[model samples]
Target chain A: MKWLAASALLFAASAVAAAGGGTRTNDDAIVGDGFAPVLSAYGFFSDAQAQRPAAGVTPYRLQTPLWSDGAEKQRFVYVPGGKQARSRGAGLLDLPVGSALIKSFRFGGRLIETRVLLHRAGGWIALPYLWNADQSEARLVLAGARVDLTTPAGAAISYAVPNKNQCKECHGAAGQVVPIGPKARNLSAEWLAAFKRAGKLDAVPAVARRVPLWEDRAAVPVADAARGYLDANCAHCHNPDGAASNSGLTLTWEETDPVKLGVGKRPVAAGRGSGDLQFDVVPGDPDHSILAYRMASLEGGISMPELGRASLDPAGQAIIRGWIAGMR
Target chain B: MKMTTALIVAASALALAGPLHAKTIDVPAGNNAQSRLQEALITAQPGDVVQLGAGRFALSDGLSLDAGGVTVRGAGMDATVLDFSAQKGAGEGLLVTASDVTLRDFAVENTHGDGIKSKGANNVIYYRIRVTWTGGPKETNGAYGIYPVSSSNVLIDGCKVSGASDAGIYVGQSVAITVRYNYVEQSVAGIEIENSRDALVTGNLVTRNTGGILVFDLPNLPVMGGGNTLIEGNMVIDNDTPNFAPKGNIVASVPRGTGIMVMANDGVTVLGNTLANHGTAQVMVVAYPKAFTDARYNPYPRNIALGYNTYVGGGDAPGFPGGAQLAKAFGGTLPPVIWDGLGGPKALLPSADVKVLNLNLPAQGAGVDQAKPALLSFTAPPMIAVPGNVGAPARLEERIVR
Candidate 1:
């Protein structure tokens, strides 16, 4: 009888936990709920959390994640301060859910173009549209609807970034799909929501919430840094099915895994001649290393990752250097 | 008849007693070059020559000469046909494992792999020879026409080759190899020298293939590209298309699509060659300094000379966003030096394949005429000499057959 009572209590607790621990607000869930309940509660908390003014009053700003065009349509470029909008061309971003995307902010001018993608369970797929930019006119093609919001309501509806669309192609595979890499792109919204429920969001800095590469040092290990750099730069051609497939050096994160691929072979004859490096990786010394030499060399014979935005990123190179330096 | 035979034997004895500077061996119709070669091996000793007649004669496979000082020559390439088509064996055609083996004016055809392979052999001279495969110019052909690896002091002169998926003429891990007066065409690579010490490539005509010429210092090899490798006075043009093997081959795979691709190589001298009409670039040099084992000791070649050569049709403009800029981005600078007095010139290895058409395509008409009256300049070799597309026209040639 006593055992039955104990078991019943345990079962009830587990059931409650399974039902989101009664922690997540109704709006926190992607399914079964709208944002009203959580929005009202958060609004109340914002009021209480507001601190009193000490000196000169500062301009108040409340940034929201929404799109003026509609909830179904995702905006590629959202200039928060300018409250401007842009759209990629047609058939660019019909991406599968959970795919990775990378966007580049090429121009320093007014309008910013961003590329979006989705990381699906199978592989990286592109969101078939692209954002084009001009001075005055902003439009979204294929999906039909161009909304440029310069007012407060417009800014409130724009999608919050540090989003995947900001750097989709920058880390894209093939043409514009976000392939798997040494680093993950963005933390899933569910994971972020889970952290919010666990009260870790306030502690996680804005910087930590940025892209995977820009996240706090705690997010990734040093050993994985080289893989991240290679993926961002060289994986396009060094894989099994790329133009450089004959070289036999698959720079993909999965193929380059030391134990599995045995990339340590001195000569990769299967590679033909491109990656016929003396050593794939030396325990110590990056300067004497062939991989490092290719990365550092500016010559056509040695420079690596063939083509893209041109020139190696100094910061990214340094990160890879550090990782190589760490290898014992 | 017996008296005539005795008089002939007496004359032979007298000839043997004379100062034997140039040795000679007679090869008749019934007895093949291999049998005569065996007899010559027994009698005349070192510094002897095996002279073969002009005839369609077949030979066995796996003939290696570990000893130095032997010469194998034929009356002419057309007359002395050595067909190894029937023998499907491993190894190369006419392999000289030792040094000082001189061969001239013989046609070696249908070799399973490298037609003429000399490994660790030095002071070898192959002159006026034709190394070929049975197939015609479609690429799916032979491995290498004249392949010399880890050898030294070699001279390849007046040879004609084609139909190789790899380099029609390849020299690797060697030093002091002079390649001149050879006609190579319609192969993966026309001439390739890799991981050698010091070499010279001059006065050759190479055209209408995948890549033009290449000097590479691959990793794990004992030697890198040699210092003072002079590539001069050659007509190298139209190394554009990919090397396709045996017309209907289902398994031969060659990575064509570039012209002159130089990767992981250093200290080369490229001078005075007419290059044209490439699928990708006129010249491409890809180096991997980080991947080098002894980067400090094995200094990356600081010198690459590209001068006084007519370059034609790489499908890119002359200036800024073209081949020159790409070269700088990769590590090479434009306006490479012309020449140095000794043998080779000085220049920088290109970092990327440069697309430049310094000359017009097809090489016909008065404006584009490359034919100089003096000695006809260059010759177009027959496609049967080189078979497959294992190598590029001017790059490293590799063929691995299971």
Candidate 2:
């Protein structure tokens, strides 16, 4: 029976078991063991505002809304190919600093949605607003989700939910450090106001919640941008226990401290007769940038971040290339 | 009464028995072939043939053979398919790590890595095997279609290979190997022989690769270039494309685009092979005897010969042999041959002068079109190529299924 369950687990990732768009029927339900219980199928607002949410709960006056106004007028952040139909939002929940949110979208009742909590280390930092967790399966985490703090009313709030594994899978390194480059994590106005009051930013009135940051792009150096991209993409599997951890290209934002990250150094076990290409970054030219060439390739030889995504966005690619071009 | 009943029953049973026939295993089209293949292999004996039905079977991992020797032949090349589309990845399609293995027909498509690999096994014959990556001919592939390594006494005959990230048919560190009558195109190297001895590569059609045929003795391998080998009867054509692999990583070790290159090797005979418009050189020999130890084997090839082969230098320019087919793409005239090895001056007999043999056979000619003279000659004191000194065509005519 355990083997049966294990074999059934392999098919779940390949084929979704949820009944949607008439894709599932009674027969398909038994195609594999429908392990989890079925929850309702609805969007964020629809599911949250329902009279009863799974267990008994009534909706009170809503502290925050899923959308600005209840219409499609709220634009999806434009990814290169399509709109943000697949993106999810995360921010300081009004519930409490340590509160957890466990929402399950109907994958045969498997608890698919996860929200992580983190206490602010530096003064309250607002992640530059962009699409961070841009997938249905993304486990969105809040930096303040686990802070052991007293509310203004003096009520002790602690993170009640269990810790998540997928957060580390997604954010890799700099896990709780809000990713503020390239894309945003859909920060909320209440969180922004709290951060400003806490003196995290130079004071600006917290009106126009979803104001676009189309301001002249800040002059962050290319090195920072390239490092940020590497942290976001490569650090996940390049660390210890990762498949390429042995190859020693640690791209974690913290580990890539330049000196530790082999940026200006030659690689080990590279350029052997086993057909290994040597030198990940060759300083200056993109043609000389082995890392950049590998990132642009699809063959198994050089393609990095071997799973999940396809090609890197052209604009993102340019920022990394700009950094490599500056390297000696 | 008992004897009479027994005789009647025996006669009836004998009458019911039918003629003996070979067992036929049928794989219906669109069936899961990974499991079916496993079952067939388990149930089959010698001389048993499994007919794979048409259409693609989304296979998981590669099929492994545990038996001593057997053959898996297909009805049509494209008809029987093993697809690794959703199976993540595996080493290769069919892995034969045992001796006396024979696999022919059918095609392995979309494998994550190598298409077919036989590692450290000998007495293997791969006939009419077609291994591709994109389900069809496609450039951005993973690596070698037919790759055999660390083995000996192997024969890969009458196979069609194309679109590998690495060489199409690569034989490395093996001896007494025969690779002939194959059509290879659009790969990094059509046929590559590295650190192997007593091998014969003849009667193959090679085109549009980074190099048609490459013989390299890589530094830091256990085997030096194998000696006393024959490279003949092959239609080696323009191999001008850069290797399809990403340039940054480890592939920088191999120099690109030489039709027939002998690097750090000896006793190599390049005879009766038609070479046309190869980038860099039609034939290049880098005989570094000191490099032999770094190449893993001592006593490297001490003799190399080139005889009786035609050279079509592609476009209208003076090439080799008094400079007849040298085109402008060859970077003016022809590249001068420099023996970057031991016996450097002595290897150029009668003169210490360098020479790059140009192949300038007319495109439309009688025997000269298919046949050509060898580019260079080498007869040192110690080593000799097979059959002593004989002129033979490198490529042989292929048998078309039509």
List the candidates' TM-scores in order. 0.42, 0.47
lDDT of 1: 0.46
Q: Which tens-of-lDDT digit does each residue in B1-402 have in candidate 1?
A: 999999999988657634565546676545544545533443334656677777866765424444466677788877887787753333356656556677787888876555777766677777888977667654324567887776667778789887775678888777777788898877777888776656677788888766667766554343454545666677777665555543211112223434444444445555566666553455543333233234323423345544445666553322222344444443443222111111122224222222222221122112213312111111322121111221112211111011
Computed on C-alpha atoms, the DockQ of candidate 2 is: 0.05
Task: Considering the two chains of model 2, state its CAPRI-style docking category.
Answer: incorrect
Question: Where does candidate 1 chain B have its weakest 10-residue lDDT segment?
Answer: B393-402
DockQ score of each predicted structure, in the order shown = 0.01, 0.05
Scoring only the second chain, what is candidate 1's TM-score? 0.69
**Model 1: per-residue lDDT, tens digit, A28-67?**
1111111111111211111211222111111121111111
What lDDT tens digits, residue by residue, belong to model 2 across residues B1-402? Answer: 999999999876445421232345566656555656654654444434556666777875445553334566676677777776654322456655555556777787766666787755566777788877664334345567887776767778888887776778888767777888999987777888776777788999998877688765543333445656788889988876665554432233334455776655666777778988764566655543221112243332245566556666633332223334334444454543323333333332212122444232222121223324233443533232354422112221121222
Best by TM-score: 2
